[model samples]
Target chain A: MTAIAGKQPNYKVAPPKSGMTIKQQALINSIIVNAIVILLVLLWTIPTFGLLVSSFRPRDLITSSGWWTAFVTAFQSGAWTLDNYRSVLFADAMGSAFLNSMLVTIPSTVIPITIAAFAAYAIAWLEFPGRKAFFLVLVGLMVVPLQMSLQPLFSLYQATGLNGTFLGIWLAHTGFGLPLATYLLFGYISSLPVDLIEAARVDGATPMLTFTRLVLPLSTPAIAAFAIFQFLWVWNDLLVALVFLGTRADVAVLTTRLSELVASRGQAWHVLTAGAFVTMIMPLVVFFSLQRFFVRGLMAGSVKG
Target chain B: MRSVQLNGGPVMALFEKTWFRVLVSLVMIMALSYGFMVSTEFMKNQDAPRAMLAIVAILVGVLGIWALYLTVDNLVSTFPIRIRDFVRPFVFIAPAAIILGVFIIYPTIRTTWLSFFISRRGTGVVPGSFGLQNYVSLFTDPATFRALINNALWLVFVPSFSVSIGLIIAILVDRIRWEKFAKSLIFLPMAISFVGAGVIWRFIYFRATFGAQIGLLNAIVELFGGSPQGWLRIEPWNNFFLIVIMVWLQTGYAMVILSSAVKGVPGELLEAARIDGAGEVRIFFQVIIPFIMGTIVTVTTTITILVLKVFDIVFVMTSGNFNTNVIANVMYQQMFVQGNFGRGSAAAVILFIAVIPVMVHNVRSLKSRRF
Candidate 1:
């Protein structure tokens, strides 16, 4: 538990000479890496970019003209509409469905994080009865495919009468989200200095106070990082939402909307594209906002090897 | 109870109090039981087909959670200490337990039962015989056979390539000056929702352009003087191509994790190896790999689990037809499309079993992580 006093091992990757103007060399190196990476990003983005542009084009243009021609046809081919967004968000049951997605995602993300943070704290610091077993259960539960649990859960829900509801989907998501959340947070919280918590407890701080005042605050980088993770996961998730929420239009989430956007046969291309974008947006927001916390060394050598 | 210290001992008498951990555990059990009870109402009214039942269940689950407060009071009385000290973690975890019990555990048991029931379609065989007919059909039907092969192909290839590419990229990027930015750009694909990635790649793999081709792969193919290919319709080859999207999306995630582990590899170890005349490749294979083997396994198994449950890309791309059907997508087809709950449950059960081993392995390594 002592601070991992070990320094980073030395290596032969030579630093530039003492007077070699390292700033210019570092700049050159970074630019080379950035250029290559920017190229990769373009390769990754262009196709999706094309799809997003195409989704806005008129249906005929979507089927015919390349999305690139939007620039050339700027003078004459004026066809872009909110119709797809309108249909995706406000379609017969979709407005309510969007609301339903919010309900499911919010509670799902919140519940797991709350519990995982606490359990993670306990696992990390609190010496308690059944700690190892409880930790093991969380770890073991991580791998149980939700699909396997679906039937058992459905019948249980049916018996209890919750087979299809916003709450059902929320709980399902929270359940699935917990294991990873606990593992991640526990991994972070455990690495924190023990003396800080011990010292506070010596000063008569309650566990809740300690968590709020010390553990939680110190764990902000981890909590934010995990929130982004859980939010993205629950947002993009379809299976649990589909199973627990059923196909009820009022309760269908964005993923369910994307799923249902397909006609009885496949080919609902127009709406599917819009629906995909809708689901992508929230996660993108969460990702960009919390993206900074995912920086490495959050817990560098908190534990010695 | 008076003799107990203020700080809790690891093995404190769990059953010493009349209603200690058991009481809180019971309250948790009922709250979850109630959540399952209430949520079905949302599915029921003609306008709200299942609303009342869902409401009652959730209310019972959520509001009734106050029972734990009673247990908290019990602990405070018996011990004269704030039971919130003991109960708070359990409280934080209660919601997750309730959700899991209702939505996952309950339904899983239900699906297992449904797998024994007969299909409503009554097309394939005499529906269900409460036997293993659905499962037998999985190995028997040519379509099912192809689906299994396709899934197997995915299982075999996706993780192998994703890990390899991820490792390669991680190693390459680790050596770069702008490590974080480069990794972020590579990880960008991961942030695109899986459904969006499908749509994204669909455009790249778009086929048969009479007038204008916007699809990048095909555009490049044309640029190289080759005819545009039907990327998703390339029969046996199509499956691998479809899996490439998963690799592209996941590689960055694997890279981020692996790169951290790689960074954790003592710089001295690699130097020590080089001192012994080991080349970069040799050092990578020797010292670097052994050090990160645990993380590598965890990442690989986690990806294995993901690949096992893959339905989104397949559903988005081909709707599991034209040689891309996985168990999850195919199950969705049976349950929703065919309205045959029995067959779908079987497919889901199969998917569940397929994931269990990798899932188990993943969890074990996760708990035992050295870093």
Candidate 2:
């Protein structure tokens, strides 16, 4: 961190006053590190790039053309076209599924964060009995696999007449998500300096007032970080929505809808690629907007929001 | 002391003064009423012809008794003259607790119970007494035994490999200028859901086996004059390919945590080591690795749990066919697909039991960590 410290900004800098050979070794070391990073990045990005490219190229071109081959005439047997995107979007069948994803993602994200914030604040500030035991259980919920309880939950949902309903999915997501959210927010918010709350309290603020006026502002970074994760989880969810949303196209999420699209029209790789990218838009937006805080917040280890 | 008595402590304390005892008595009386009333109602409905309604009534009757006391308390002076110190936190965590218990805990117990019975297609319930028959059959069956072994392999390789790579990256990236962007690039896979990533990898690993080759992997192989092999169709080895997808998705998460832990290593210690003629490799192992061991263990255990319950990837990729079945996916087939809820539930119970030892140890370690 202090490498740039005690340095003159305008002067040409000399390195370590070491021997020429050592300096050469350091330069070589940096190159190797950068080269490895570049290679890894290409390996990671090429497939997605290929899919994206294949999505746009005429279907046959995708079969014959390397995504990287677009650079040459030999690979360019056909011109690029929007046929796949048009088929997925203008085609009345898939458009509604896109809307359905919106419905699930929006509410699934909002309700959990709202409830968690309130509960987290209470756990953080409010004194009560069995708090330790409750905290323990909340953390433990993180370990239970969703698939294990899924059958019993299905039966329960059936009994409650919530099977195959948006409301049911909402409730299920909230139920599954609450434990982690509370544990995370509780860990973060509770560790905030008690002086902030006490200072507010001394001014005759009630608990609610103290939380809203003092705690929430400080905890915003943590809340935002969790929101990004929960939003992505619910958005990219397939099995949860599949079991609860039923086979109906009208209620299925982007994931379930996309998988169904794959089976019914996997031939149309064009739309699948576009649709995948479209589904990716929200998370990418969320990630970029909160990128700086992402590392800091995660690194803070839930102890500081 | 005089003020304590005078202020309604115990100077021949009036009913209001001694209301704590009264409240306790009232609670006991309400609980007794609830138990008796619920038992009577439950007995009345025990003979109900419809199985579902009878079960519902049994549940409702028991819950109704507890509801009655809560209602009665609300109607009267719910709060004592002095607020109960513990009530506020209960109010805070109560909603979360109640939902988790009903949804998570109750279902867990239900699964364990159902595992004991037989729900074959031949009968509504597994028509027999409870024993270790299902578990015994599970272990004895060659197919199931293989799946159990595969799941164990996943537990060993997926978490450990992903975490190891993450540790390596974290160490490497800490020295880089564009660390955040580089880290996010790796983390990008995690943003894609297992299903979404599964869809993408399917195409990458796509094998037509004949005609014009399209899959990127096979396409590249053919480009290199290598024979096209159906990657996903290969047994045993195919599991490693599947594990790669999980590694791809999770390495970023592990990286973020481990990177943070790596960063948390004190600079002075590393600087001192450097002064003592320690090379970068030695300093990393001796200083950084030891500091981050706790976090690495936590990440490993968490990822192990994920691996043990691994379902979606196998389901989406191989559909658990071709000997790629993990425990959770197999459980689904047995319970839902095969309609052998007993066997399925048994599979689930076994998985749960397998997890408890690790889960208990994790909770203990997590709690034992100083705040």
Candidate 3:
């Protein structure tokens, strides 16, 4: 891993930098970079922004003009209304779906994080046999698509009578979520100062005590990161919920409900926009509030140990 | 057992024994398991009051495990070091293991088995009809073949574009003052649900029969005097349009990751390249890219896996019609819409097979990074 300084090949020099001579080149580079970056940012953002604007415009106005045109027309005509929100929230029963989403999401997020935290603590700190094997299995499990688990999982739910319950979706999410949860927490936990755990052990604290009192307290950042991640994941998930917790109105979460809304009312842009925003609000808030941890988690997911 | 004479009563002395601690843990585990099973039954019956009661019971069950552990210190003190160490990890690992085993591992094995069975509507997997018929049909069916080709198209296009676009953005935004703001804007879509993203992009790709095309893409095209096109329904090209949504959603992820990796490149090396008369392109290709090659590969593979499992966009945007069917979406249709569990399971297994090599590469690269 040592840097091989002398063995490096050197390219032939073209010329010495005439300080002022490069100024024009630097200016041109800056212009190109700024232009490209701005274009990219606009391209990345305009779709969502369009939808956001369309959500705020009147239903008739939305269908008649592009969202961009709403700036001129809707403002001139005073056509913006809260009717889409009213209809989506009340008439479309999205309010119930929103609550159902929360019920399914909170437990699903918490259960996996709790279980993964314990497993991560042990795998990271404890002296245990089959530890590497356990970790490798988790890493391997990360690639097992949720699609693969649907049919059998449904039957398992049927056998256990959990097919259409909130708890059923929660457990299904927990199972699907564990691999990444454990992997990320383990990465964060293993990198923690080993001496902290060792010092706890030296004081005769049991593993459980050290975990709760020491590791859990200190691992809050990683916990928060994984918590946000799992929350957003379970919140955004459509497949798992759709499979285990059928489309029963009593149990259907926001996604299944929203997708069904799309299926049934495909061209209803006004309601769909409002509904989409409602579904996105919580995750967006979580993302903005905890942007740092979210970015860190993304980095950890890709740039692994 | 060496019983230390203590001022406490016989109850305290009994609690001090290793076997007593073992007995307590065993009883606590059994009780927790029983409560878990009972709560699940309540869940199945859809008994509302009982379901709420089950939550309380489960909470008490979890708390009991915590309460048991709070008292375990003295119990473990009596055990020999070998015995104590051997059992400790299990106490922490068992909950995760049981959940993963029952839900993930067991289901995976069952899915593979079910793939060999015949599709029976409603009930799933007709017995004695077991064979490779589903897999056989998976290869032969034209629609399935088209889905496979579409998946291959996704595999080729999505990752390459996402990684390259992400890398380009990462490099461009590096020296800018608004790096954080720019990155956040790009990463914002990652917060949007796939279903939500589908809705957002539907506006962009929206088309109509006549009059001042409302969708941005068509608006721009029409503004230039080109006719409005139904972008999503145009076959083959439709798949690419759907992929654009994926790329738009994912490029930010790749950017956030690769941006950090680019920041990690040594300043001295870039200076050295500049001094050696390497132009921006030369220096980028030789120095910067090589240094961040590992991250690029990681990002590519990560996005590749995402592209393979892409369902929501197809599911929401077109429901896999207009020749946009992907493996995962097709599998969903078979299992849920068509009620053909065997065929669906087979599609899922094919997906599983597709993801393995990428996962292995990821694991190997990660393993190498450890040292």
Candidate 4:
């Protein structure tokens, strides 16, 4: 949301009118920029790449030699194996944890979008009583530290019989997610031309009809953006799942499970690597596939408000 | 589903009246409650077959809400336009309000209340009698003091390093040939969970047997003829090692945002600076930096809040061991692990108080932007 509200940066390369000396200077500048960019890129990527390479290497080699050494004819030396993935997937029940992550993420993502779409539309277009006050509160709630809510919410869950259930975690995620979702969607929906909604109303379309038919379709970009953000967030979350759902194997999401593996199996780098990879795969897919929307969502959050 | 028309014959017209529609709304609400019950029960006992049932139950619950909406909409449609105008927005905002109030707002108040009272294990707060003993102990305890100091260190270091590196990379990468590809690499760490990043960097800092250091940093140390050291076991430095993971994760976010801001700087300004015989370094600091200062502040503020609540990395990496405890981790340990709900609530209240000024500033900025 912040990114979207900012002016789109001009990406055109400026051509210089210069003599031979200036041309050489430009070349030197380009060379320096390229060197620094390459160095930083490698610096950022090598750690994760090393972890990925270690995920494939045998446990003995992972603990015995640095992962970089495996890059030299790693496969040719027969240092690679599928055993880590197999053991993590089967023996450690990470496969079920992956499914559990999906189960927690899908409804958590969907319910918020559904609820926020309506709320955002109303805040954006309708002249309801206390509209500004309500919008202000929502915006303010965006920065509330979620740690404050954990203990009481956990206790409340016990009273309501929602504890340790998927429904409880889903509700927690939705509540935590709503402020920003509503805020981002409100930005997009509010910016939609008044003429369109007025035109729909001038016809015989009811408010619900207008929202379902016009607002929902028109707000897909915002919806897709929030969807991707929420999906990655819910899928990758460790804290909420740990607190609300507890660490029971059947209920543990991928992150909680992987963290538990780290705690209980601290020396098992092979399994940890593979398990980490397993948990990472979904968010990575969502991120890469929906990268444009994801970045848009980030920019939209700050720039709009 | 849309084919069902309420505007039909006399009998249908009678059913479409406000009273009949009100009955439908009530029934739909009951249906939604029932669906929730079934779903919760299904999820609570998830086994092989029941897992599938749980998934189906979720779908049923969602559909039930949708059906409730349709029913409520038909009821609202039966109202006069003026009444509908006011009622419809309330209808739309009600579900979100209920959930947020129950989950976030109510808990916030409850936590504040719990902070004043004492907690008993296995049960919740004792409710009426209130005291400041929890807060008193929270501030005086050495562990908490260390945690506060560590949080201050994180607040200072993480944002500063992240913003500076991000600014440097963003400035450097813009003139390169593979700008998008390189920026993507820098931004890649933001995609990994903090837990995952912790594991990745743990490998980077791994220490093996003497003379056979396996971690990249330790290996590099050994290659320089220095002996290997346990990176995470060392106090103060271990905190720095953990901070490195956060810097790695956040720099990409800062870079991507700042890169766009840098690109937004007008070309003429840079050209004018260059014509005045300014070097690139001076152009960057004096001309370019000043232009994008707002975005730089925005990025810094964003990372500042993140550093404040940074629990996942510390939780996963050191579990606050070796003097790495921060406020959020300490709060969590007190609340859940130690079952000191009163103290945990106090810690949480402290965190909430810390966040209020930032959020208020954010809201004011947003309001100013609107006009």
Every candidate's TM-score, chain A alone: 0.79, 0.84, 0.89, 0.90
Q: Each predicted complex: what DockQ?
A: 0.31, 0.23, 0.49, 0.46
lDDT of 2 by residue, B1-371 (tens): 24555687554464444466466557766776776565444433323333343343334333443354333333233455346333534544555667778767888888888788776644757456687777877899888888898898898889988899888888878777988778888877766767677777877887764466677888889899998888988987999999988888778778989988888888778766766667788887888888888998888876777677777788777778888888888788887678787788889887788777765765676676544
Arrange candidates, best DockQ first: 3, 4, 1, 2
| Model 2 Cα lDDT, one tens digit per residue, A51-100 | 77776777666666554565565344456777777776657245666666
Tens digits of per-residue lDDT for model 3, B1-371: 23455455788787666687778867765676786576666655654763474465347435644554454444554568888778778878887898889878998898998899997676755779979999989889999888999999999999999889999999999978888999999999998899999888887888877556778999999889998898988877998999898899889998988888998999788877866778889988999999999889878877887788888888899998988898998899988888898999999999899888866865676765541
**Whose DockQ is greatest here?**
3
Candidate 3 collision pairs:
none
Stretches > 4 Å off in candidate 2: A1-20, A73-78, A90-92, A199-205, A264-268, A293-305, B1-80, B83-89, B120-122, B209-211, B365-371
Q: Write the per-residue lDDT of candidate 1 for residues B1-371, one digit (tens) a residue.
A: 34455545654655465566557566666765565444434433335534453444445444444344334434443443455456555644555456556545566677787787675643533433779877888779888788988999888998888888788777777766677777776777777767678767776787744765657678778888998888888898889888989988878778888888998988667656765667678888988888999988877776777788888888777877787778878787877677677888899888877766665665576568643
Interface RMSD of 1: 6.4
Candidate 4 regions exceeding 4 Å error are: A1-20, A75-77, A301-305, B1-29, B47-54, B80-82, B122-129, B368-371
Candidate 1 residue B318 Cα shift, in angstroms, is: 1.5
Ranking by lDDT: 4, 3, 2, 1
Per-prediction TM-score: 0.75, 0.81, 0.90, 0.93
Instruction: Give the Cα error of residue A33 in candidate 2, in Å.
Output: 1.4
lDDT of 3 by residue, A1-305 (tens): 11654345434545435654444766877898898999989999888888888888888888888888876665475668888999998999898889878878777777777788889998888878888778888888888877778888887777867788877787788888888889888888888787878898898887887888888888898888777777887888888888888788877889988899899997888999999999999988988988998876655544211
lDDT of 3 at B354: 81
Model 2: lDDT to the true structure: 0.70
Candidate 1 has a TM-score of 0.75
Stretches off by above 4 angstroms in model 3 are A1-21, A74-77, A302-305, B1-38, B45-82, B122-130, B210-212, B362-371
